[model samples]
Target: MSGTVALITGASSGIGEAAALSLASRGASVALVARRADRLAELADRIRGEGGVALVVEADVTSQEAAVAAVRRTVDELGRLDTLVNNAGVMLLGPVVDAPVEEWQRMVSVNVLGLLYTAHAALPHLLAAATNGRRKVADMVNVSSVAGRVARNGSGVYNATKHAVGAFSESLRQEVTGRYVRISLVEPGAVSTELADHNRPEILETIRQRFADVERLEADDVADTIAYIVTRPRHVAVNELLVRPTQQQA
Candidate 1:
């Protein structure tokens, strides 16, 4: 990944942070995008301490303009954009009845719209990089969820958003794969991230009990999966990967 530049959104914590560190270790100059500047700075320092290049761009991906600017800044500062990780997302789980409308909006805004905004801004650069950059191939990895594959009680809206991500990733992959731009979807099940921390108290309790018996995955686990996808040879494209804990059934 030396001489290549990768941009990751939602990079302050969890899988995004892990992916940034992993990619940096592999020699890719990383651009870390998130709303938290402090966290981004800390991560960037850590990357630099390891003799890796990192750029911190603070922006909210849910806004189109901010998302576009984030991509532009990465290219302006890092020279090229070879990989984009559209990983900014939220999961708010609850039954439809009496559920907070704000929760649904939040899920859709971050999980779906935010992904779209980042993808839109990064596609042109990714295409150009695929044809002109060192690797000769560009990657776009969308961090979806296992909920994308199966709908469940109390997670209807979350399911819808993730399903939308899968659909968008597949459609975009078909449109760009012929051009050496690979699009991949990573579906993670029961990862120990802050995703579940946003739920209401009742929903949070339900989630805790449901996963009480199962040992969940760590952020680095999914980050490893993403790193594998992007680090593959130009001719190899791992389109969709579903990673679940050994104890997770759904």
Candidate 2:
């Protein structure tokens, strides 16, 4: 990854932040995108302290304009774009019957639309890199969830968004794999992150109880999976990767 420039959304925390650090450590110039400037700055400082090149771009991926600008800014500042991690997403879980429609809107906006906007903006750059850059191959890793594969009672909207991600990733992969741009989907079963913090109090308690006996995965664990996907040889394209904790069944 020495000559690569990778941009990651939701990069201020969780799997996004971990992936940024991991790629930077492997010698990739990383561009961190997220809504939080302070957190991005903190992560950038950490990466720079380790002698890695890190660029911080503050943007909300839910908006198409912001998403496009983030991608453009990354390419302009980093010289080239080799990898895109569409990791900006939100999970607001609850029953759909009387649930707040705002949660559903938020999930669709970030998980589905956000991914689309970033991919749309970054595809041309990724293709260009694959054609002319050092690696001769580019990667797009979409961070989905196990919820994408399994639809539970309380997470209907979240399930829909992730399922959409899986569909989009596969279709895009088929379209671009021959072009040397690898599109991959990463589904994580259950990770300990701030994702659950956005749930309502009632829903949060239910989730806590459901996973109380299970040892959830760490952010770095999923980050390692992402690193493995992008670092593979050009011929070896990891199309889809599902990571689950040893104790997680679904």
Candidate 3:
């Protein structure tokens, strides 16, 4: 991974933040993209202090223009892009009957549409990375959830969005694997992050209580998996990784 460049969206916090630090630790120049400019600058400064390359691009990947600009900025500043982590997402879980329609739109826009916008802009760069050198490799890591794999009550739209992500990852993996571009999905069951805070207060409390007894997977856990995937030899491609806390059954 030395000398390679990776662009991670939603990098101000959660899995995206962890992945940025992990990639930097392994000698990859990282481009951090998120809406919070201050947070992005902080991360970039920290990485630079540690003698790793970092660039901050303030963007909301949900917008197509923002997504395209983010990609172009990474290439303009970093020379080339070798890996893209499509980790920007939102989680809004509520019963379909009474949930706010706006919430559903936000979730779909970020989780499904945002993923597409980012990936659509990044495909050319990723394919270029594959033919760039001896590694003959490039990576696209989509951060999904267990919700994507199993349908459950109270999470219909969230589940649908994640399922779309999984399907896209698989289909694109087939399209580009032989071309040396690897598309992978990291599905996490639960993690102690702000993902739940985006929900209604009562709902958030209820969900948090369910994990009160058992420690959930940390953002760093998923980040570590991402680092491991991109750090492997060119011949190695991890198709998918499912990470759930030992206490999680569903």
lDDT of 2 by residue, 1-250 (tens): 9989999999999999999999999999999999999999999999999999999999998899999999999988989999999999999998889889988998999999999999999999999999999889999999999999999998889999999999999999999999999999999988999989988999899999989999999999999999999999999999999999999888
TM-score of each model, in listed order: 0.99, 0.99, 0.98
Residues 129-161, model 1: lDDT tens digits: 999988899999999999999999889999999
Error of 2 at 151 (Å): 1.0
Q: Point out where model 1 deviates above 4 Å.
A: none
lDDT score for residue 200 of model 3: 91
Candidate 3's C-alpha lDDT?
0.92
Per-residue lDDT over 112-165 for candidate 3, one digit per residue giving the tens place of the 0 to 100 score: 988999999999999998898446899999999999899988889999999999
Cα misplacement distance, residue 64 of candidate 1 (Å):
0.3
What range of 10 consecutive residues in model 2 has the weakest lDDT sum?
94-103
Error of 1 at 153 (Å): 0.9
| Candidate 2 accuracy as TM-score | 0.99
Report each candidate's C-alpha RMSD, comma-separated, in the order given. 0.6, 0.5, 0.8
Q: What is the lDDT of residue 62 in candidate 2?
A: 88
Question: Which ranking of candidates, highest lDDT first?
Answer: 1, 2, 3
